[model samples]
Target chain A: MDIDTLDLIDQYLRGNLSDTEKEAFEKRIAIEEDLQEEVLIHQQLLAIHEQEKISLTNTSYQQELVQMNEILNEEDNAKLSQKIRAIGKNQQPHTTVRFKRKKTVNWFYSAAASIVVLISLFFIFNTPKALPDYYQNYVNWEELPSFTVKGDPEELFEKGEVFFKNKEYKNAVATLSIIEPEDKWYPFALLYLGASYDQLNENEAAIATFQKLASLTTSEEYSKGYWYQLLLYLKTNQKEKALEMKTKILENPNHYKYKEATELDF
Target chain B: MENTERYIQALIQGEDQIIQEIYKKIYPKVLAFILYNKGNEDDALDVFHDALMYIIITQKEKRSVILSFEAYLFVICKNIWKKNLKNKVIQTDVLTLEEKETNLSAFILEQQCFEFYIAKFSLLSENCKDILSSYFNGLSYEEITLANAYATVNTVRQRVFKCRSKLIELIKNDKEFQKIIKWGA
Candidate 1:
């Protein structure tokens, strides 16, 4: 297009043209296809330029979101640690009462009783061949390789993974929960989310998340989710359900967790 | 129309509560669609954010609403996700017939053209960039002159026009721009 026509397009865009000139320009645009094309491109370019500015403003918003996530995770971690310490403190009085009862018993009988209790406690704490023992033997928490994609969301994923790897279950849960459900990392996030909940002893939440993950037929993470659910049931002393999951794993021997599932005692 | 307008207004204002409500209401379907189509939650989130940004920009620039908010947002998200999954084989059932019925090609073209312009805009001189940026940001001629310390309002106007024209010239000369225009046609 010529300079005058370009100028006219710019003026029209800025609403700088007079009424008569605007009328004439509109008529020319209706008749002249090239002029119309030029006008459209100009408008699109202007719109894009404006969009660039709006996007610039979003940089700070993205930063704030990252900062907020970190702060929230820290707060949750602190609260969880405090609760765990309080629970430990509460258990101390029960142990003291048991110690006092042992002191008040007759000397000869207490000696005999102590010997039996020591053997029983040793067997109970050190050599249990039960579900909890199997869980302790089989549960190996490995760090998932950090899969970084190009975006702000990836930062959250990485942070959540770090918390998971560090065994900061509460922090991991807080960080991963902020990730949008539609994110590609969401299935992995859900997997870790359920694992974190399990570690924190939030059995119901863990089971719920694992169930949700298992329900997604399209997810590559589905089989892994089912396997985790099976382990979770075992962890929670649900032997019947764990056996059902064992059957599922045995049925699909080619599943990712098939080998591990085969070795599980229950 | 009223619902769309309210949504658009909520977006422009960056109302966190409404935005959260939007996510709660709409994101699950988008997430399911992405996951089924070989996309992950990450791709879905990125597509949704980009789509929302496009809507905000379009609404602000046009000062008008045409399509329903849900339809417009879904179409934008679908197009962006398709673009992201260009190399992957997509399922035909990803979008329903009703969604496919929306004439989203125009908006898609506009987005492409905008992206192209942004890429080319970075190549302009700093002075030209500032002038054009200020102009597009709706700065008054007098305000632009005051900000940039140009001699007169007329000078600012001329410089803004010159910078915009230069941008157009650069875009016209670009091979990618030619391809985009042809593809858009």
Candidate 2:
């Protein structure tokens, strides 16, 4: 209880006390129940302190994860770039980023579908679906689709349209591709998918997809058809084409979606 | 076995595969921990995520990890709950469980006792608290002295010793804490 005894106890903890002092403190703790009790408390606290470091997902950790995700994304992009260059092919990164974005949108749909599936499983059987909850929750990322775009091409287009209405585009794209010209929904799918590609920062794919959609026959073109393409061009800073699309929109002021298109700058 | 193999490796590598593994293998445990801690489904989820993130960070940082990943995860979650308590955050759960004669029960009790001791730490004078905290934070005597503006390293040393003794006194006299140990033991 005395300051000297307390100081000696502290030094003992620090292992900084001279040998004589340590011996004295040890003796006191042995003979004195009160001193022994104090030692136990200190030791307990020490143990707790040693094992009790803070966790991330604490705000500090979240900040770090954002930084980490950015780094990982950059690494993935680099890997993708290297592989693309190695392919004895002609492709642009704009296209790659577009492809990545489409993948991202597909994942978004997969997540939505997984939720629907989970809800159905819960309701139907009051149990988890075949997918385990943990992995099921992580189905935030979808893989390439399993459904083929086969059947009567026109019927497939009809099915694709239904899917588009349901917002299942990966399946819709597969379905629609078999139909005439693929143009019935090609413009819409192309533009949306191109945007998806853009969202993933795969610029080249987005531009090419958008351009191909834009070049369809005038009969298929919306009065404001170019707006969608223009948006893609604008996104990639393809000023010439974006401007051209804008001019096309300007010339056909009466086209459907044109008023809305004019109100916006691509 | 293939599923387990795929998931655990993915988890070990910090991939999303562990999310499935966790849902299947460990989510029940996490949910149980949450439910015991007076938490709901949401807390169970948040704690589970935080624990996994902590494990990945620790592993990535090359910390020596020898415990079963399951045990390590629960401990991290428990620690996070304690910090939540200290920060006066919304804490609806205390993870109370019936005393039982099992190693897991003992470990839980041990954690409860440690938490009790840690709570008692706040009762000390701020200076005493600071000195003790500095020591535990791995501050050197010189760093402690410089930070606290003590006259010398000897002064810092003397202060830390006194702080430890005071902490002991606080811990011994806390009856509630003793009861936790008794029930836990």
C-alpha DockQ of every model: 0.05, 0.06
How far out, in Å, is residue A116 in model 1? 42
**Which ten-residue region of model 1 chain A has the weakest summed lDDT?**
A93-102
Each model's total of backbone clashes: 7, 18
Query: What does candidate 1's lDDT look like per residue over A187-249, in tens digits?
Result: 778877888888878888888988888877787668767777786877878888878877887
Scored by CA lDDT, what does every candidate get? Answer: 0.61, 0.49
In candidate 2, stretches whose alpha carbon ends up further than 4 angstroms from where it belongs are A10-25, A52-266, B1-101, B124-127, B137-140, B152-169, B179-185
Instruction: List model 2 lDDT by residue over A1-266, tens digit each.
Output: 66666545546875888888788778877789766655555555555566652221234434434544443235543343233223212211111101110111223234334432111111223443332232222222122122223342223333434554555543333333333344334454454455445444556755666567667646343432365556556555566776787678777666544554454432
Q: Could you tell me which 10 consecutive residues in candidate 2 chain A have the lowest summed lDDT?
A: A92-101
In terms of DockQ, which candidate is strongest?
Answer: 2
- CAPRI-wise, candidate 1 is incorrect
Q: Can you write out model 1's per-residue Cα lDDT over B1-185, one digit (the tens) per residue? A: 87787778887676656666666556645654564456655556556665765565456545643567777677668767765565245444455422321212234344645556776888899999888787777687799999989999888877777777788788888776654554332
Name the 10 consecutive residues with the lowest summed lDDT in model 1 chain B: B97-106
Per-residue lDDT, model 2, residue B163, is 76
